[model samples]
Target: MDGLPMGRRAFSSTSPSFRATARVGVAATGVALALLLVVAASGCEPVPDGTPYDLVLAEGQVMDPESGLDAVRWVGIRDGRIATISQIPLAGADTLDAAGLVVGPGYIDLHAHGQDEENHRLFALNGVTTALEMEVGTAEVDEWYREREGQARLNHGVSVGHLGVRIAFYDDPSDFLPSGPGGYAVATDEELDTIRSHVRRGLEEGALGVGMGIQYTPGATRWEVLEVFREAATHQAPVFAHVRGFGVEEPGGSVEAFLEVMGAAALTGAPLHIAHLNSMSLEETPRTLQMFEEALERGLDISAEAYPYSAGLTSIQSALLDRYETAPDTALERLQWAATGEWLDRESFNRYREEGGAVVLHLNTPEMEALAIEHPFTAIASDGRIRDGVGHPRTAGTYARVLGHYVRERGKLSLMDALRKMALIPAERLQEWSPDFRDRGRVREGAWADLAVFDPETVEDRATYAEPALPAVGFHHVLVNGIPVVRDGGVVEGVAPGTGIRAGSWSPGS
Candidate 1:
């Protein structure tokens, strides 16, 4: 409490001196009455005694990128919102001494694929408060929200996915994404109408937006994709897309895919988001980002995001992998089996393709990943999914990796810039569709008290591709709606304070 500004102290009614003064005033009412009348005329109100908050994070380096605030301060929380931020010490029922820690808004992962309890626990340990499946979203928004109502560890939501709709219509027995006939076959006119109806219904039922994985559904015609964009435009919702192709190999390259989505945004006037631009564009990332900048300057609402790792993950049965079958030996060398840590040759690639599983493609280089991360317009997202405790390291490590490697160690990005990408940018992207997002992703008074406190020098991601389920290291405290789900570097047992996030309506509980 040293070097802290003093707040107005409340008079102690129980003190012996105060009692003596009261007795004297009662004995000399004439003089005391005049003094009391003068005091009342001054219009000063008495301060009430006791702690003012339920929780206080004291003396932390509070950083809020949205407000451009970065300094040591005290944060007071009461009834699930930030009540005050002060230069003085605050009294509370509980005080966490965070003298050397960085207090910032909790990270929001917009393209998270893992929306279950196990992954939520890991995400909390890494300081993420909201995780949404906006790339390959749910088929039934109602059922998805219902299932995770009181069971989630962090805020969760989904968009209505074109791939999920395709699977549902074709009756494909795929869990994570569509494959086989649903992924490869073009829809008939009746089926297309049914898809449109489902998309519209999902919007009505409170989906965040429309999700389309054009690369996964290669058979979806340009006209069909545009119709989906138009449906989203009708509701004024954004479209999150994994565009049609990958790499810089002309004709049907990543540039063409970027143009296709940008054109849809221009034609339909719907906001568009490109998923994993680094992995999609590869060596052409610089040129691709230039195109995005140009489109943005032209008044088109287009944005892009990327993960920190050099590799990307997907099902072995996906169309992108099928295209790689005819690719060169170098392409096969880039394929890393998820179950085992071995890089694939042509023989191993064929074997895994037949067996059907997830694979990590080492398609992007470190330089390319850095380029995407350093871009001012690009946001950060973990296109991560976890199943049976075996998945990509991005599931547990994306945000921490950005903080640790990009900001702390390499100095490629400043701390404020990294935080903006992880938290503020993602929240801003979704706030138009969901008003609940307006209160998140900031460490300011009156904002929702979802925050992360960590040691700037020590934060690091411990998860690796070989052992992908390990939680991160330096998140000391994480709060959701002013409730601690993580404290002292571990998850607090029996505390599930997270609520479901929905569009066009506030969630029922914090």
Candidate 2:
């Protein structure tokens, strides 16, 4: 392939010089030397001159929130890593002309639950490069990673879930979102030890961190929670949690839930990540952000994330709806059936609660949702999951919605700021757990080539409550590991370059 171009080589046995060389005793050697010289000269011939890359995105407005770089530039990718970012042209096997588009790191979803192929496709179309199961993570972390190997469309990872381990320890029948003994019964001292052992084993086996859905497992005592935190601290893994409760109402309220996790973080010295703070705090989201800021100020490694939507999704069988039996009106008023898209009244709520299905609660106001999203410290994460094809629009549209509504339409956030929340912040949060994340979430050279290219003026989410599977628009291309998973505004078929992102491969300081 490196030989001189076809029909361009100067070789002719009938020529006078060739004939002269043939007449000599060392004709073969002389001709070979001539050919070598010609080949060397051909190496200097003008071919495609720029540095060769596997892929090149040309003339795009590149943005890197971490470095605060936003400029029109050419980006080159080779061997699944960013090879160059230059003002000059680049040569590649494939080139995507990204004129008038914004090129940035692909969104990383820290609290995502949809790790299956279908949801991954949706996530790719929405410009998410990594989708993790951090809230209700798996019991068998090794099995989960193995099953998705060579099959996923986006980078994926999971936490060693407290709820899943508890269910497994108690032989509970639930597969996800505890409902039976795991949700309602306090564990014995021996049972707690078993659960802790399982969590530690999972972390050792490359689970991203410990996932605790304290709200799902109300029966989990403070001691059990503390034990999980201690295990997390030992492994230097952050704990991703849906706190113990929600709403501003007393007894067991959202404030108390926040305090529980905060105290655990303080006591056990475990990093804490609060999930879906907008939904959890609802009207009190501003206050919650203030608390998170204060926690940061106090030298606590605490962070939080929120989706753009004003609703939250969960299983009806989970303990989150346990209050519905008595105070049905307030709960039912905010609840909507995910499958049928119907606003749940007392009658419908009761039926679904017994039958067991996913429900969306309109627990947050639009103002509060926006406030949480605009919070400087809050990252954007989709608490996204899908069943069959029915689920929250956030499963397909969270990142795009932020770019579209929050940044472009409403001007609530700068484009760079939104990208920061979606990309750099999430990567920063998990880089301590896995060194693989270090090169992610940036557009500079030597970074992993996970990128999203979209029209800044046109990018927006179209998914809605009635039809939640709709993919976002205006994303010209989305690449995972420098492979185009989405091209020309559609998901490419039969390409899966995604790899499992695991922890424990490196220590925090390393």
Candidate 3:
């Protein structure tokens, strides 16, 4: 209730004939009044005075990276949208004292693999409002969206995944990624047509985009990948891809794999998003970033994301680790069994490969990871997943780790820039394809009232590799669809305000 009031500019006086100046002033006032009336008729009028807002966050350091707003302000939410942003206080049905806290747009994770209740809670606790499974998305796109509607804690969506379609086609026993014939069996021309049809159907069902895990489906030919890209292009859908291979080892290395997909995007004119640029490139992260920058300069619709961590996680049975059968002990020791947090030897690696479980690979260096995270163009995303408290730490820790360690502790990037990477960049990447995202990722009036309020000095990730489920600390409040899912550092009980996000054109079950 203690702040400066909003003010309007005052008209200046000049030397002129009194009658002429009076006439000009009166005419100007008439035009302005006409314009104001027109605006009010068009439903652009300001909120009526003395009418209480649904919710108000008072005296927070409001930061909107898009508009470069960094000052204390009061925010009023009404009907799940930000209705007022005032320099002074606002009255509301419910009010939160946000003094000394940073109120920014809730983070958006473009590569989230955790969409279940457990992970959604973690994401909300960590200040993420929308967590999308874009890397390896669902095969039954409509069913996937339907299952989460009104049940999820955070906004959710999925792509129509190439990996899932291939696995389903081959009847592969693996659930998440291809491990058997799906990985090794090549598709015939007719089979390729069937795959393209499924991709097209998913788009028609309102999938976020085409999700491709080419590395997991090794048998998918270059031509097959291109045809899928073409299908996505026809729908004006972007392709979120895990390139075909990893490492800088020559021949079937990261360079070759990246070029293959880059070529696909170029040939078909499909927008491309490179998933987890840090993990996929490892030591070659800088080089890959350069390639991405150059491609952007050449008018390619390309973007990349990275989590703030030095390790990666995946199923031991994935085709990505097929060479581990012949790999030396040195290479095998880099893996840590996610179930028990024990380092793996050749014997343990082989045993886990047969047993089929998640394995954490200590593959990247801190320096290389920092390079990707610190890049201006790279968005922050948690390519994260966990089940029953057993998985990598990135799922629970990514955003906070970036804020606490990268921005606050190390001074790697400004707070605004960090928020931009976490919120705005990811939203912009998908807004072109999905109308659900157009007003997201900002703190402006009329934007969605999805917000994260946190104590900048105290916020930090508590989740560790050994204890992966530990929720982050110092998030004072998180709101989804203008409802508080987290308040005063704890999750609000029994609330499910999240809704399914899809492409603009498709309706439910259409």
Candidate 4:
């Protein structure tokens, strides 16, 4: 009995009380010793002497991917941070019965484009606590942060995008993504200097990092991209890039496009994050992933993200589809007009290209998607955006889809691994430059109380191409900064607890 098995030891024995008792060399009497043994056997941390916690989640499977913690514990939240995690129940002013639920760090979307109230509400239902516009970030970093300062429902941030800068530089006719001169005009030496100035200014204004939609701005020369990478490096910022090409079209295919950014990263020591590796790599996902892995092994500070989806959404007018005219009729047929959910032919494709809007391209195969998603190096990000409830399913379903389809149904990876991709990995990607991320993406004490409590059995995405705005199901409660944004499986209206998540090193004046 004295040498009880490790597995049978009390879970609460890891509590601060046990450590305190050990350090103080306290001896216990028969009754006191029995109480101590029972408490240890019960796995509840010895209740510290303190006022009751502000809120407590009781009897839940708390999963923290950072520490590989998977156990039933009571989580105590106070003043927007986790105060304690105990195996035994603790007193709280407010408590939620979290029985049969998994309480974990809220998901973080590093590539979310929809930062408005509408999208934030959906993001909450999807268990996303922080939604970042990293792939096609805003040109107006200050304005972007200011707009969402107190209006957003979930934590938000943005990157300063090269596409936005280029669009403004050329006075592009289209919004969001360039369709006119911004897409096609090659920059002169002076023009490059002007673009570089705007990029530097954006970073100075406290952008999370630089966003480069390389495919959208085909006119940007390799040297011009290298120049932008230099600017990001100057500020110790990462470059989140949509690599220049898609598919295996030789010359400028996915392999070469990946190399371009990796090369820039190597030359300038700029950290790089490739956006939507599944969409960017297309048919060559495996090869590009290998390349990404090799580059990481070579000591490059680089990472990639992918959503659990096959089709990708982008503006039909983007340079990405400039080749649509020459693309086989079969290819054109696969482009689904988001407005009507109708497949487009050459005529429809051209018509939509002239009248720019979102188009859902059914591009990659399921096999290819599974490959990218299952890879260990990739983080889970929703390169998702919705405007007036009219966007890709990914805008709403990305996270839940991963939890439901990939983790639960297919068993491609472990649930802990999925949480790591959604939470810890994304945070770690930015933590080097943004110390604010240091406390995020974990369920440990002193971490921000951004928690997502959901029923793993029924948790799933409900959004589809035909109904892209449908909110995901299974999340019972979502807390942002210890405030419930989603309660009882619905969005809690009239509350805006979201804050701007920005880099720690540089502020407005610094």
Off by over 4 Å in 2: 1-51, 506-510
What TM-score do all the candidates reach, one by one? 0.89, 0.89, 0.91, 0.91
Candidate 1: where is the Cα deviation over 4 Å?
1-51, 505-510
Best by lDDT: 3
Q: Is candidate 1 or candidate 3 better by lDDT?
A: 3
Question: Which has the higher TM-score value, candidate number 2 or candidate number 4?
Answer: 4
Residues 1-510, model 1: lDDT tens digits: 221111111022243332243244344444434443122111222112443578888767778888777766668888888888865456667878776677899998889898887888889888998889998998898889999888787888899999999888888768767777668888888888999999988877788989999988888999899999999998889999999987888777989999999999999999999998988899999989999899989999888899999998999988877687777877687788998888998888888888889998888899989999889889999887778878999989998898888886777577777888999998899889898888999888899999998876678998899988999888999998898889988898887778788886534442
lDDT, candidate 3, 358-457, per-residue tens: 9998999999999999999999999988899998889999999988888767775777888999999999999989977878999988999999998776
Model 4 steric clash pairs: 11-43, 12-43, 12-44
TM-score of 4: 0.91
Q: Global lDDT of each model?
A: 0.82, 0.83, 0.85, 0.85
Whole-model lDDT, candidate 3? 0.85
Writing each residue's lDDT as its tens digit, candidate 2 over 212-262 gives 999889889988899999999987799999998877887688888898899
The deviation in Å at residue 251 for candidate 1 is 2.3
Q: Please give the lDDT score for candidate 1.
A: 0.82
- Give the number of colliding residue pairs in candidate 3: 0
What is the Å distance of residue 249 in model 1 from its true position?
0.5
